[model samples]
Target: MQIVILKDAAEVARYGADIFTTQLQRKAGAVLGLATGSTPVALYQELIRRNQAGEVSFKNATTFNLDEYLGLSGEHPQSYRYFMDQQLFDHVDIDKNNTHVPPGDAKNPITACQEYEAKIAAAGGIDIQLLGIGRNGHIGFNEPSSGLTSRTRVKTLTKATIDDNARFFAADEYQPHLSITMGIGTILDARKVVLLATGENKADAVKAMVEGPLTAACPASALQLHRDAVIVIDLAAASKLADIEFYQHIEAENQKLQAYLASL
Candidate 1:
């Protein structure tokens, strides 16, 4: 696990965008694992800007979203598919046909979950996966106690998660308490993973994920086992972490090492 603490949300987004920009530069046909929610919006917007500037292209890219609300069709305004369309996909050059979001309205969610995993396997797995941590330390809706080695499946959202997301729905809006999400094991299959968090609200969760024990109680902590997992956050989000100075020093040394190697 690599921790990168930046000045603020904007810097975090730009840093995350730089990773994606570099990935696309290296492999235009890269298979991407995507996420939704308020946290990743800025980074997605930055990617959109770069795409418009010809700095990166997703035309040959394929993407698989991490999760979707059960019972909501893709066309629903609140569906994750719609969220991706409005935030990243519509603005980028990615082919709609190459983008896959779990079938929220599938007749058989169990079979759909297996199919989702199969599609990912067929794409050679996700080259890079992007994530946003919930305040409760959940990743991709894998709330507390979700099996660390679980695969793609349906999960019932916890009350905390539902409350945190309630703002997205109107008072009378039908809010789904169920979701289809890629399990922690599935997310770990990606060659690289980038997780973004910002604001003071996420400070506790960020700390738990970065500094706490590697247990299922904190689902995002599973990233600790991944060979390449990057956690990017702002000062506000990183405030609760105990070893801030150590993390900063390490990042600085890594920057120097990377620069030296590039010049060699």
Candidate 2:
């Protein structure tokens, strides 16, 4: 687990974009794992900018989104499909057919989950995975008590996640109670992973993910065991860390730390 305390969210976004650009340059047509949330909005914008500038090309790149709200059609405004099209897929040169989002409204969601995981494997797995932590430390809707080796499956949203995500819908009642998400095991299979967090609301969960014990209760803590995961956070989100200064010092010392480092 390596910690990067960026000065602000914009800087974090820039750094993330740089990572993707460099990776894509080194390995064209990379398979990417994407996360959708306010946390990644700026990063997506940065990538779009790079695409327009011809500094990067996602023409052949493949994307696999982390999760999607169950019971919502792809055309639904609040659906992950709609969100990705609006925020990223629409702006880039990525082949529309190369992008994959788990079927949110599949009648047999369990089969859909298995097929999603299989498709990722067939594409050679993800080269880099982007993640956003839920307020309760869930990743890809894999809430507490979720098995570490769980595969893609349907998940019931915790009340807290529902409340946090409610702002996207017309009303709380519009929020889907279930979601289809990649398992923690699936995420760990990526060659590299980047988890981003911002704002004071994320402070406690960020701290727990960074410094607390690796327990199922805080699913994000599983990153501690991953060999290739980087956590980029803004100052506010990192505020609760017991050794913020230490993290800052390390970042200052090595601006080019590898994507992963042993857990601190």
On TM-score, the candidate that comes out on top is: 1
lDDT per residue, candidate 2, 1-264, as tens digits?
879998899998998888889888988889999999899999999999999999999988999999999999899999999999999999999999999999998989999999999999999999999999998999989999888878899999899998888888885357799999999999989999999998899999998898999999999999999997899999999999999999888877675453435332
Worst 10 residues of 2 by lDDT: 255-264
Candidate 1, 1-264: lDDT as tens digits: 889999999999999999999998999899999999998999999999999999899999999999999999999999999999999999999999999999999999999999999999999999999999999999998999999999999999999999999999999999999999999999999999999999999999999898899999999999999999999999999999998889999999999999999999
Clashing pairs in 1: none
Candidate 1 regions with alpha-carbon error over 4 angstroms: none
Tell me the spans in candidate 2 whose CA falls farther than 4 Å from its real position.
256-264
lDDT of 1 at 95: 95
Question: What is the lDDT of every predicted structure here?
Answer: 0.96, 0.92
